[model samples]
Target: MFFADGLNCSNFDRAVFQELVDGGLGCVTVCLGFWEDAVASMDALGRFRDLVRANKDLVAIARTGAEIEAIAGSGRCALVIGYQNTAVLNGNIRFPELFADMGLRVLQLTYNNQNEFGGSCYEPQDSGISRFGREMIPELNRCGILIDLSHVGERTSLDVVELSEHPVAITHANPATLVPHLRNKSDTLIRALAARRGVIGLATYANICGEYGASPSKWADMVAWTVDLAGIGHVAIGTDHGRNVGMPDLTWMRQGNWSRIINYGAGNAARPGKVAEPGWIDTMKSFGAIATALAARGFSQDETALLMGGNWLRLYTEVFGETDAQKQLAA
Candidate 1:
């Protein structure tokens, strides 16, 4: 369901994703690109599109809660297209809508370094949204594209939260109450984002979770921090699990400015003590158990459901909900 690299729906191993879905992963915000070119990303999406057409019985793209609801009820998981970087847009405004049409519902503006849109969390400047980012906001708004600031710079995250006409999303991030990782959104930033009524997906990427993001509870600690700071409504589970392998897009970032010394996608393999550590979910743990733990963390059932998936669905309906054009398009 997390449309990872290589094994896009084209080379999709349904068995892997299906286990998650069958185990109750209602909707999966799948990744499509990290540092790919416009053509390559589009080619990747097109392949997914073809797969959707070929496998309508199992998977379907959903832009609305109704579709997601249908997918979940049918005992299949909903696929929400996502991108980890804007590089695939290739510095063009139109790509937001074009990719939106291709079903790219969620997008993180930058991966690790500066791009035309904004400074990366790893970039020296970290000033905020660039001219290209300013350009990207309105059009992404117009196209009903949900903005994700997960891997973007702190300043840029604040700016987009303020600049966007609709709520934005930090699809996968740690709350960052402690030291900042290139991908963790700080409490201040998370609160600022929460003020805009956005959705913040708690990721299971080991590097970002502390214990080098390798421990599931390290992930839980981040979520607990977000819950402490942003509250359950602003917190949600989002294991940034890619696939059998991490995306080459991350490899592509190394050619630019990778701060961490190891592979971002390795999860916990490279981290020395993580595997030996107790209860490090690595996000590979049964997602349902993750949900149960979140509930036990004092998250009320309503808020628990929201953080689990409802908030994301509501945020989607709010932004991509019923624009006059989208209404017509849906019609």
Candidate 2:
């Protein structure tokens, strides 16, 4: 059975590559930078590209759904490059096509803090998408880059959902109804997302999953609930579990030269080096256990398979199938 993880921010090293290969994960949306500026973002992505090139046998950069499907069961995992924030774009309306051409298929409109795009979930005032952001949407759609609204403010997220011509995604967020975290989505948003035929990859981050965190059963049940709430084809796994393997770097992830005051996000003042995840669903390899849990939760085999990876594959194909000519013309 082919499994897909919505996101993996692990080190681009042989060990992590081997783990994905061993885990039987077909694809992962990789983080190039959390909050990098334009030139720095390009440089970081260049380095990641080098890593992929260096380990061609273990992973291949997948630009289209066909590429991801072709690489399935080929003893290697496909890397779907993405950005966690739009700071890298530096408010440039033209760069969406440029980055899309570079094979970065996913771009988040905002991170935990506001930029030119609009407000963040962490902001006091949730301003909706800015005028510049409104302008960028058409270009992003024209470029066939999938829009991710994971860390965006509630209003901005809704604005994007209404404005985007193509379906958008919340690639690594959970339902706030369950966890009540700032980063999680509301029931209204989830229902709207599904109505648009978009996908939401439920995140397995400790805080977002809940205080007790995610065991295989807990994880499965959360997914089952989301499936019931959003429909089966709209729920998938995006275990935001990358900080587990290496030295934790909240400073870079949270501050990132954006603020003078330390923003220890998620209200953890201690800023623990590593946030613990439940053992059963902690790593990439454990993703398949979700399938078992889904089946046990009374999901049919077909529904379980769709939740595992088929839904992600379907979304990927719909958004990335556009040809260069089509994108250019759409521009």
Candidate 3:
């Protein structure tokens, strides 16, 4: 079975795109905008669409499971447009439908800071989902947008999972039981997420992995433990991998416009930059190595398929609905 990467923060550079294509990914969710206002977000989406048009042979945009399957079947990468933050909404509820019409499929409720929607993991006190967030959740559900809570606070994440009609995602994080990082999810949250049939994409990002370090074997152990806790169906990969990322990009992701000084997110004064990715799975091309690692860890082909991409396809089908072709087939 083909696989999907739930979240890839890469700049979508041609070289990066080439690696994804070569890596044998059936589908990938790329970050289209984060911390951008509505206008700027639209512009970014336009540029991304242009990029797909320019490289039509290598990639195609997909908004549903059937489309993703068809694109991958044709030997092209299926790109799912997503946002790391809902800043693009600009406090307007109507924007969800607007972006969804434009082919957006995944929307993260909050990034590293609290916003109109809800509280963030970085916040000292999490107030849970705001009134606007409660209103926004249903709109997002009606529009078929997959809600994401990867960087949200505990109270807020639980609140969203409870309130959202459809299952949500913690698109790229590890278990805090293993790492104890604020960015990682706790046992309670993971169980709650799994109980609701949500998926938590296991991250290969180093800081959250903590002592797990760079070993593919260790990474597989992390995946195994998650499966043991959340069941095999609820775990998947969201590598958070990027290509040619620099300090400026890191600064922008961590600080945005909210902080005058460097926020040093997932970093400190001694190491104030992008955390080193596990060497084995550092780039898109190396992503397949994760499959081999899982196999070595005694996961069956069927189980590995679910972890690699089958589970994500199932989730996408649930939230985005099947395409006309699928409907016709069922009919």
Best by TM-score: 3
In angstroms, give how far residue 313 of model 3 lies from its true place.
0.5
Residue pairs that clash (backbone atoms under 3 angstroms), model 2: none
What tens digits encode model 1's per-residue C-alpha lDDT throughout 1-331?
A: 2111101211255565565555566677777766778998988888877876676666677876667777778776677887778888888777787777767777777876777778777667787888877878999888877888877888988999999999888876776656456567777888888888887877655556666354444455556767777766666666666445534444454443434465443233455222221244422336665566656666667766776677777777777765345679888
Give the poorly placed runs of model 2, Cα more than 4 Å off: 243-248, 323-331
Q: Worst ten-residue run, lDDT, model 2?
A: 242-251
TM-score of 2: 0.94
Q: What is the C-alpha local distance difference test score of each model?
A: 0.67, 0.83, 0.90
lDDT of 2: 0.83
Cα error, candidate 2, residue 93 (Å): 0.8
- Candidate 1: where are CA atoms >4 Å away? 1-12, 211-221, 246-250, 256-285, 322-326, 329-331
- Tens digit of per-residue lDDT, candidate 2, span 1-331: 6688887766668778878887888998998888778899899889988888898998998888888977876778999989999887877788887888888898899898888878899998989999998999888888878899888889999999899988899998898988888999999999988888899998877767784254677777788788889998899888877734533466688778767886766646674455776688666767777888888888899988898899999999988876576569989
For candidate 3, lDDT tens digit of each residue in 229-287?
Answer: 99999999988776787899988899888789868777779888777777787778887
Ranking by lDDT: 3, 2, 1
Assess every candidate by TM-score. 0.83, 0.94, 0.96
Question: Which residue pairs overlap in candidate 3's backbone?
Answer: none
**Comparing 1 and 2 by TM-score, which wins?**
2
